[model samples]
Target: MTWTLVTIPASHYCDKARWALDRAGLAYIEDGHMPILHWRAARRHKGTRTVPILVHDQGIAADSTDILHVIDAHVAADQQLFPAEPALRARVAAWEERFDRQLGPAARRLVYFHLLQDPALTTDVVGSGAPRHERVIFRGLFPLLAGLMRRGMNITPAKSAQSREKLQALFADVGAELADGRRYLCGDRFTAADLTFAALASPVLLPDGHPVIRTAWARVPPAMQAEITAFRETPAGEFALRLYREERRASGL
Candidate 1:
């Protein structure tokens, strides 16, 4: 059966799944949707309200990580997300978990906190891969959608501040790990952890050729732009950008 990846298009988690599938050379169709509209599609496919869900003839992979595991199972060993060595694979999994639990949410909160303030840019970001009618609908319902997203994602002043701090700390940790001059997060080779970090960090880095069309850096709030500039200069952030420029496009997807 052909694989269909249901996604919000600009979602970092969805990017992770996309990267994994592409890296594994798996052919799949992307069924993209706008924000809240994706919940219905996700539920129809996998009985879940979140996206990055993969559906195939065999069954459904309801999460990005699950999709990566599915790809790993189908692909050759060398193309697997996890390393062959057990210990290294464990480290990769642990790092992937850390980034998924912390970096991903923190990045989302930070980005949404700012984007929610500007309806036009928010629409642009969310409507990138959606149909024209859906884009118009999103613009029309943006106020309601923004409110729901803020509440559901807990994007308050306090949480946004906390998310910034968390993101800085995590970036510092990643920089420290790379300080020893290691090529990848877990080892010399690319692994799931590196992909997770690069994909999740895309919101902040706004690497060129990203699936999403981000607000211009010049138009960002001064304070946020400063933070973004600093992060982009960091070793870890550079690593993520390099991964996107080198690995992400190489798949030719």
Candidate 2:
């Protein structure tokens, strides 16, 4: 059997896996979930319910970063993903953790809180077979995307604020880094760090006409929307934007 990458369509975490695998030029069968039936199979074995689980020849690689690292080792010759320098590699790895765990959650919350309000988008997601629905769509399956979105974050006010602050501060640093006018996150080349930041930050600075959501998140007001745009214009966000367009098009995804 081919090694399979189980992912959820439009999931940022899933995008993380795809981004890594694509950059490494690794060939793996991708299983994208909308009904999420394969995810149930993963839960049965992996003992956790998460998308983007990789079933490699060795074993089940559960985490996005873990999967990336595993594939990366095999393709170590590919210098585009991770930096060749030890110090740069360390810094890039650290940024991956911070972005995935910190900025990821805050942006998720900021978007989810608002997404639940958009009637059209909500209907679309529910129609995507999200296991359940809150009210009207409870016509058949489960209920509430909110519950699904909220899971794993364990977000309290304190934690949420902390993540938000860290995300803002970290992005500020990234902005400063890009102010020197580098093409990618680390140097003139695209790295895993760039992919992580761009993919994770999409909710805050959503790509125009994204097919999945297909609309501006209703939660973000015009003022904050402006802030998001400004952030996108920042050196860091600009890099992210360019990467999204360039890499995405180059891959023909």
Candidate 3:
């Protein structure tokens, strides 16, 4: 039976789940939705209000982390997202959790703070990949939806500034981990840690290889574009971009 992935077309967390599933060679149809609209979809699947809920023959995998575990159980050991070794697996989990807790929300808030300033751009970015009717409805109701999103996410200027600081700190942490000249976050092999960070950071960096969420550079506001450029120059940023270039694929092999 084919799996169905519930997703917000522009959500980085959804991208993380998509990346893992693709790498595992799983074929699934994605049911894409807009921001507030995704809650209804999630509820229909008996999942918490979040995108990237994977509905398979066996069961429902709620959230990106759960989706990864489901994929890991199905794939070969070598192709798993988590390391087979205990210590290494713990380290990967720690890193993945940190990025999830810290990077994902912060990056999302910061970008939304900027993107919401222009209703049209916001519609194009977040409303993408949904059905045409949804897109049209979203565009018409963007003012209301954007307000709801800002309030739900608490995307104030102060919070956006705080998120910027958090992003810098997390980037520095990644850079320190890579200072030893290791190819990937956990040595030569790419793991969930790397995937999580890269996918979560995609909104700020907009790396070339992303499947969705590729808003044109010209369309971005000047201030936001400057920040993206600065982020792209960092060691951590470089690392994430490289992973997108070389390893954001359907299989590690």
Candidate 4:
């Protein structure tokens, strides 16, 4: 069977999976949809109600990171997404976990606070306030849109300040780590850790031709955009940008 990537358009989760598939030179169909459609597709697989699920001949791989793990194992060539250096690879993997779980929330909140763009999709998924027609079509899919929205936006001023400060600290660490001349996050070779960090962190350090970069970051004011874009031009952000250029989107980016 052919491989397919089921995901929400412009989702950083989806972007991470895409980065892996693209880097591996793997061919797959991309099933792009809004928040509601994502849940509908998740039921077809086992153990997944999230985007970036990969369905290939070897049954279905749920979870974005899990999907990438499977891809690294099954690809024809022994192309490594992890560093060959064992200690460094382990450290990078630890960083990837934190970035995916912790820093990800803060960074997402920063974008939402600055943009105020919360398209609350939970109701649409769970059949709360959505149209009757949508409920019928959606069936059992419970959308996580609201949770995503809550993570994406900080409505109260206090919350926004807290999230922004957290992100500022995160960025400083990332910048400091890249203060030296390492091209990739794990120091030279393209690895899963870098891909995870780059996709989630892309809001601040966006590269060329990414769909979300324009909508997410551009929503900010001109002066602020300029400031953030310049920061992205730094060694850390530049490292993420180069990874997207040379590895993630080698075909187009």
Using TM-score as the measure, which candidate wins? 3
Q: List model 3 lDDT by residue over 41-158, tens digit each.
A: 9999975898889999899988799889998999888878898999999999999999999999999999999999998888787877887878788889888988898999999999
lDDT of 2 by residue, 105-159 (tens): 7776655555545555544542342333322443233344445545645445565
Q: If ranked by lDDT, best first, what sequence of candidates would result?
A: 3, 1, 2, 4
Please give the lDDT score for candidate 1.
0.85
Candidate 2 off by > 4 Å: 34-39, 123-145, 151-165, 208-227, 249-253
C-alpha TM-score for every candidate = 0.95, 0.77, 0.96, 0.75
Query: Could you tell me the lDDT of residue 171 within candidate 4?
Result: 65
Preferred candidate (TM-score higher): 1 or 4:
1
User: Highest lDDT: which candidate?
Assistant: 3
**Count of backbone clashes, every candidate in sequence:** 0, 7, 0, 0
**lDDT of predicted model 2:** 0.65
Provide the overall lDDT of each model, using Cα atoms, as 2-decimal numbers: 0.85, 0.65, 0.88, 0.64
User: lDDT, candidate 2, residue 240?
Assistant: 71
User: Which residue pairs show collisions in model 3?
Assistant: none
Clashing pairs in 4: none
Better of 1 and 3 by TM-score: 3
- Against the true structure, candidate 2 reaches a TM-score of 0.77
Backbone clashes in model 2, listed as residue pairs:
131-142, 132-142, 132-143, 133-142, 133-143, 133-144, 134-144
